[model samples]
Target: MARALQACLDGEVDEVTAQRVAVHGEGCRRCGVEITVYREIKNSLARQEVPDEAAMARLRAFGADLLTTGPAEAGDEAARLGGT
Candidate 1:
């Protein structure tokens, strides 16, 4: 059921499978809630904006810096970048 829900949300299931999931969700309260939550999360993610080129460039530079730095320096850099 969880697999079906995830497949439906991800649009990976075919029409027949999707119809079956929809019908099952209609009859099962738990499935209905699961579908609603998945749909909301999917829609929310879909509405997110992509980062700009400058932001991507900065991330690439940070990654390169981390790769070149020693472990201790990497930890400090990660802390400076607000990463754990």
Candidate 2:
């Protein structure tokens, strides 16, 4: 599940993989929460107005942390931070 989410984020997962994940999300509460978190994270990032190096560095640092921890842990951290 985490793999699928990461793949989706990286644009590596095909439409079919995404669709399968969507279907699983429809039936599983946990997966649904993950998907919701994913969407909220996406939207929050899209809404950010970071127009400087500091902001970009922060984003890069976060990305590095996310990479070390993987998707589920990153999502959990985001949830803790009121991200999703």
TM-score quality measure for candidate 1: 0.56
Q: State the lDDT of candidate 1 residue by residue for 18-39, as single tens digits.
A: 9999999999999999999999
Identify the candidate with maximal lDDT.
1
lDDT of 1 at 77: 86
lDDT agreement with native, every candidate: 0.87, 0.81
Q: Could you tell me the lDDT of residue 77 within candidate 2? A: 86
The C-alpha local distance difference test score for the whole of candidate 1 amounts to 0.87
